[model samples]
Target chain A: MIPALGLIVGIALGIFLDPSVPVWLQPYLPIAVIAALDAVFGGIRAVLDGIFNDKVFVISFLSNVVVAALIVFLGDQLGVGSQLSTGVVVVLGIRIFSNVASIRRHLFHA
Target chain B: MSSTTPPPPPTDPTRQESGWSRLLEAAKPRANRKTAVATALALALGFAVATQVQATGKQGLESLRTTDLVRILDDQTSRNERLDLETRRLQATRDELVNGSSKDEAAVKAATERLNQLRILAGTVKATGPGITMTITGQPGQVTYPTLLDLVQELRDAGAEAIQIGTARVVAQSYIAEHDGALYVDNTKLTLPYTIKAVGDGDTLQAAMNFPGGIVETIRQQGAEATVTKAPSVLVDALQQPPTDRYARPVPSASPSAP
Candidate 1:
C-alpha cells in the first residue's frame, strides 16, 4: 500500500513539475521503464504467492533497470544499439507477461 | 485411549498462545522498513518514467547526436536560401505584371510613341519634319563614293531620323556602292548633282555640316560644291520593304484555363 501511494505521488509530481530529461539519459529511459514494469509485475506475482520480499523486490528493480541500460550502452558502442534494445525488450516483455498471467491466476483462482 | 487424549487438554491454550505470538512477531517493524525502501524505489521509477515520457513527447532533438543536429540546421539554412531566391525572382516577375497593369495609361502612351519612332526608323511611313537639305555639284570623278558615305554618316550622327538620297529611302539596311565610276544607292543610278534630304532638327544638322574640318570641309577638299539649307518642313516619300526574319519565332505564353 505504501509503495502504491509512493508511485501515485511520484507520478503526480512528475506531471506537475514536468522535469526535463538530460540528453545522455534519453537512450536509457525507455529501457529503464520497461525493466521497471517487469519488476513491478514480478513483485505483484510474489505478493499473490505470499512470498513477497521487499529487499529482493527493490534489488531486482534496480538491477533490471541498470542491466537493461547497460546492454543498450554496450550495443551502442558496438554499433548494434537498436538490435540489442530489441533483444532486451523482448526478454523483459516475456517476463512481464508471465508474471501478469500468474498474478491473474492467483487473484481469480482460474 | 480417551483417558490419554484428555490429559493433553491442559497444554492446548498455552500452545495456541505461543503460535499467535510467533505470527505477531513475523509482522514487525523490520517488514515495515523494507516496505518503505521498496516504496521509495517505486516512486523514483515512476518519476523517471513519467518525466522521460513527457520529454520524449516534446521532441526528438535529445535523441540526435551533435553532428546530426548540425546537419539538419545546415540543410534548413540552404533550403531557406533557395526559397528566398525563388521569392525574389517571383517578386520581380509579379512587379512587372502589376506595374504593367497599374500604369496602363502611361504604358499605352509610351507604346504609341515607340511605334511612331519604329515606323520612322523603318522608313515605311511618310515622314514630314523640319530638316536640312544639301545639293552637291562636282566633277563626275571628284564626288567619290567615300565622300558621299561620309556625308550620310555625319547626318546620322547628328540625329537624322529619316533620310533620302535622290529617290532612294535611307533605312538602316540601305546599301551604297560605287560601280563603273558612278554611285548607286539601292540599285538607283545617281546623276552628277545629287540632292540629299534628311528629317531632323535643322539647326543641329546644318551645324554638324558647318563644323570646322567637318563633312563639308572633307567634301569641299575633294573639289565638290556642297551646299546646305535648313527647311521648316521636308517631306520624305520613299517607303521601305518590310523585313523578314527566318530563324526567330515567338514563344507561346501559358494560357488560362477556360472556365
Candidate 2:
C-alpha cells in the first residue's frame, strides 16, 4: 500500500516538475523500466505467497534496474547493445509473466 | 492395560534450523525502517520511469547531437519565416480581390496599365506619339556603332519611352554591332542618313540631343551632320517578334484571386 502511494506521488511529481533526462541515459531507460516491472511483479507474487519482505523487494528492484542498464552499457561498448538488450528483456519478461500468472491464480483462482 | 506405545523416535536437541526456513523468515517484512526505505526507492523508480517516458515521447530528440538539433531548429525557423512572407503576400492579393467593386475596378485598371506598359517595353505593337526625330547624314566611317549606341543611351536617359532607329524597333534586348564597315541593328543593315524616332516628351527629347557636348556635338565633331526635330507626332511603325523564353516560366498562385 505504501509503495503504491509512493508510486502515485512520484508520477504526479514527475508530471508537475517535468524534469528532462540527460542524453547519455536515453539508451537505458526502457531496459530499466522493464526490469522494474519485473521486480514489482515478483514482489506481488511474494506477497501472495505470504513471504513478502520489504528489504528484499526494494533491493531486488534496485539491483534489477541497475544490472539491466549495465548489461546494455557493456553491450554498447562491445558494439552489441541491441542484442544484449533483447536478451535481458527476454529473460526479465519470462520472469514477469510467471509472477503475474501466480498472482492471477492467487486473486481469481482461475 | 494394554501394550506399551511404540518406542518414540529419538530427537536431537542441538540441530540447527535449515537454511531454506531461515531465508523465508528473513524474506518476511519486519521493521518500520525497511518499509520506509522500500517506499522511497519505489517512488524514485516511478519518477524516473515517468520522466524518461515523457522524454522519449519527443521522437528521440535526446539521441541527436546538440549541433544537429540546433541546425534542425534553425532550418525550421527560416522555413517558417519564408512561409509567413508567402502567406502575407497571398493574403494581400486576396484582400485586393475580395474588398468591393470600386477596389476591383481600381485593380483592373492598374492591371491593364501594367499590361500596356509591358507590351510597349516588349515592342510588339506600333507606337505613335509626340516626340522628337534625329536625322544623321555622315560619311560611311563617321557614324560608327559606338556613336549610335551612345545616342540611344542618351535618349533612354532622357526618358524616351519607345525608340526606333532606321527600320528596327529598339526594345529592351536590342543590340547594335558594327560589321564590315557598316552597322547592324538587331541583324538588320542600316543605310546612311539614319533617321531615329523616339516617343516621349518632344521638348525633352529635342533638348537631350542638342545638349552642349552631347550626341549632336559629338557627331558634328566627327564631320557628320545631325538634325533634331520636335514633331507633333512621331510614328515608330516597326514591330518586334515576340521573345521566346526557354526557362523561367511563371508559377500559378494558389489563391482564388489568381488568373
Best by TM-score: 1
Which candidate wins on DockQ? 1
DockQ of every candidate: 0.27, 0.18
Overall local distance difference test of candidate 2? 0.81
Candidate 2 residue spans exceeding 4 A from truth: B1-31, B64-231, B234-259
Q: Cα RMSD (Å) between model 2 and the true structure?
A: 19.3
Span of ten consecutive residues with least summed lDDT in model 1 chain B = B1-10
Q: Residue B33 deviation, candidate 2, in Å?
A: 2.5
lDDT for each residue of candidate 1 in A1-110, tens digit (9 for 90 to 100): 66777788888888899987887888888899999888887776555444566777787888888999999889878877778889999998988887777656545545
On lDDT, the candidate that comes out on top is 2
Fnat for every candidate: 0.50, 0.36
Evaluate candidate 1 and give its CAPRI docking class based on DockQ. Answer: acceptable
Residue-level error in angstroms, candidate 1, position B56 = 2.1
Give the chain B TM-score achieved by candidate 1: 0.54
Clashing pairs in 1: none
